[model samples]
Target: MTATAAAPEEDGTAPAGGGTASGQDASRPVRQIVPPEDLHATELAFLAAHDSGPRPPGWRLTPRSVVTFVMGSHGAALTLPDDARAAAGTPRRLVIDGKFVGDRALVERCVVTLAGERALLLVGEPGTAKSMLSELLAAAVCGTSGLVVQGTAGTTEDQLKYGWNYAQLLAGGPSPAALVPSPVLTAMSRGAIGRVEEVTRCLPEVQDALVSLLSERRIAVPELAGGPDGLAHATPGFNLIATANLRDRGVSEMSAALKRRFNFETVGAIGDLDAETALVRRQARAALERSGAAFQVDDAVLEALVTAFRDLREGRSAEGWEVERPSTVMSTAEAVAVAGALGLAAAYFPGDRDVLELLPGHLLGVVRKDDPADAARLRGYWDGPVRRRAEEGAATWRALWDLRTVLEG
Candidate 1:
């Protein structure tokens, strides 16, 4: 009935013991389950055995379950039983963390592309959760997303292929011990997901390392003394997922060959207001709890904050009044931070002044991060849309326009 309500089980009954509140006569008390540190290959194997679809080699779940894991499952809750949850020594629920927040279709495309043995490339603006999505996808399929190469201006070919252990190479003369595998090579050996973040940030030559790896499915280490095993061939379910920031356009472009080798998916910003508000609320509460701070902000306040963000971000009011969007990204992350700030303000200031009133100021501060042009953009939003809405007599818009001085100053 409510958003926070516990969804019913398959048998059309409430979850075991009716609710989290258990009576003395009940078998066990309910406990909340948190995710574990590492999701191992064996653990993946077990889940795959029970998983309901055709699984690819080395993958724990079918592509469907893998999607459910990253996007969350609503059909059947995979929570631990109450008794199991309460048992001290018993293992907790196998919680799959969903790091990405956008489309189910995008996630499915990424998974499908990987399964097809194609390198997957995620392209998106800054702060669009491109890196986070890659990490979750890798973790879900391979049981670990730890094998990562952070691509930057200084990224080298050795970082993509392999580097020799200097001491071992000198003494033992390029044996297996001397052959140091890069994350990509390690994933190839283990049949796991290898990640390259900000791939476009790397120089053209460095980016070319991926071209050979994807097409040939092996890395040639000439320094290792040529041998059959010296060329690392991907076993199975081994694929690379790389993210490139669209905002960083001209930094370092990938070669045509490298680009052609990968299937690309573009991630977009949050478009749903309610979803964005809930995301902000969830993250704000989590932040407060993590810091041992109490949360008391009202839902209406959060809605208003999200609404303002959406309006400024899209350069239009909900009813279609025109505004100018700032250059800064109005990501869900920024909304979460603004909500957290309001919560802290409420805790400290303790006033009747509505939290929504603090939005324009906080938003101005967020938008005016590094450039004066962004401040001008905020002014344009106020002068155009805010003015129009105020003239049309929307009380909330009028009040927000009154606070335009906050941005101007």
Candidate 2:
């Protein structure tokens, strides 16, 4: 049965009644990071309570509510009726939180596509939150986002379809009980979203496994055809959400046949600097707090770091100043990581070691990858953007420009 989460108390946090995936163990002093599906269980229930719109088969919320869950509620409120509240002996109101920040039109299109049969494919440059968006969509569509396949060169067809439990196979032969369902198969049978991450990282042959499953909406278990197990046909709501890095596109490009089965959506980096900076600080503080550390990374340092990354990522300033783009992706994810590291450094190793001194080195680490020429490209960044910005009399730029030697190391 789908669990109904308790409405939030006067504060935003949910009441204790609804059991969520985020419930901590009383026996162990450990932090458990919950997925979107679990973390927003109550919120989803609340949305469902107020939704009167039509939904696709097997969907938990109306398409409108799904979009609201992602883009956030723009002052939409759902208050329990007086009679219902009195009857239930509880008072509650549902106010949804906007989770993902991006183009509303894009999110609306994605929701519309997922409501139908065509699989959704999100392609983007690194750090674009393509995967995060996919997860949120999956969680909101169904109630679980655990059915996922991480695509890699070594990922086999068995991982996408079905595998044999060796012990059961040996003891009982290739029977129904011996067959282990892959995430894709599990999603197919249960009518849930199955995710394929880094789809291009897998070899052409292995990646092709999805083509048949998606087109036919089924997977045949040939070995058990004569017995109990045969074809696993998809249920009404079965769908796929695949993500590929733009950098990895041509590596093992999906065949045109495979691409045709998907609705392609591109997830790009945050367009606004303030939004990106807030995301960085929010993610960094959350990460730091999880590690039992106070986040003391200065706002000035974060702004400087995000500004540098934005410049390097776009190869141009917000003012349209030209800069040399790095060969590697300087994604917002990398920026969040750098921010987290800087915060931890401040909390643990408090001293005269200036946080600004570490920015150039961390950026160097982000850019210095694969191609040897990337380091040169980063050095060129310091000379061009850093030099120009410092000349404009910005103290942060002046400090980073002064530390040009750090990039060299």
Candidate 3:
């Protein structure tokens, strides 16, 4: 079957309906956050046709293409050959934009792990895009990114393994028809990728359920034992991609046995200043676009915003001056959010206040999240870096230095 072909139901039949479960109007308002699969469907289909190389079983694209899909084509346009161009809904020429702005090698490692059918664990700081990478990888590998379990303190083993429809069970008495498969179980049966976000947040016992599933690659349905639907075996491409935040390390630590079942990759913040600034701009602009407003934040203001975040994040200035790091993470994701707020402020309240004037307040808000003392740390940052930069006569830093009172309040 082609990459775009609709997947069959667990019972090996095409889905009955052509409409949504609610039968909501198709022309009604769309979702705020579209899934990666639907958002980049065309790119996936194009890449599938673009590369006819050997793919791992049950995979939509070759492993190499999966990496390219995540890291992008690096500004080079990929032209679909004449034969492949005729495939419906795919553009003849397209430049795949980079989604995750981290190391290419890290993405490659993730793809390789999935290709090998081993569970992949992405551990990172709270806002380092681990979930985004998981979603993108799942979307690229299996043509769908919807198979996911959001880990939480309330999470249960049933969420990772299986549950049952109580009414259906009462009617059918433990039949396969009564089963409600978890996202992981469904992925096992269909050879798709399943994601578990913030796995560390789940209770330790609830999290341990994955140990047997990852090792054995099958889920046993004891209720249906000796029947045709007794056990659900994993299809060839079945794999799991889980994300955990570094900040949540001790919340529900994984057992050594459970940890051994997966390949762990640590995703870190973007290292390059220019790349981070560009990403902040791109993400902020996307946010503004979603809100139906133009992105009017200036480049100099964005650079200054990013610079302050980096200085605080790294605990040192670009000029090698010491900075007292705050207890809270000054992540790039937070930077993007602040930039988006600035854009909105500029678009909605033009000339009400300079956008640059709003930066310190936003930074103060971010810094004060974990501890109030961090506000003092932020003030110290201003008294140090802001003071030095202003003394150096850079106009943007001088403007920020003049607004130290914003942080004071």
List the RMSD of every prediction in angstroms: 6.8, 4.1, 7.3
Give the per-residue lDDT digits (tens) of candidate 1, residues 1-409. Answer: 0113334445543342122221111343322221221322222332354355688888866898677666754434354444332323222334333445789998999899988789999998776778778877787788777899999999999888888889987897878877888999999999999999999899988988788889988877665545666566789889999999897768888888988999999998888887787778877876665555667788866886788778877778888877677878777778889999998887777886877688788988988886668888888877877778789887777887888888878
lDDT tens per residue, model 2, 109-228 = 999989999999999998899988999899999988889999888899899999999999999788888899999999999999899999999888887888998899999999888754
Query: What are the per-residue Cα lDDT tens digits for candidate 3 across 83-191?
Result: 7744574556666768889999999999999989578999988789998899999999998999999999999999998999999999879988889999999999999
* Residue 292 C-alpha lDDT in model 1: 51
Off by over 4 Å in 2: 1-32, 74-91
lDDT of candidate 3 at residue 78, scale 0 to 100: 78
RMSD of 3: 7.3
Top-scoring candidate (lDDT): 3
Best by TM-score: 3
Clash count, predicted structure 3:
0
Clash number for each model: 0, 1, 0
Model 1: runs farther than 4 Å from truth?
A: 1-49, 75-99, 347-357, 387-399
Q: What lDDT does model 2 reach? A: 0.82
Weakest 10 consecutive residues of candidate 2 by summed lDDT: 82-91
**Clash-forming residue pairs, model 3:** none
Candidates by lDDT, descending order:
3, 2, 1
State the weakest 10-residue window (summed lDDT) of model 3.
Answer: 14-23
What TM-score, computed on C-alpha atoms, does each candidate reach? 0.80, 0.90, 0.92
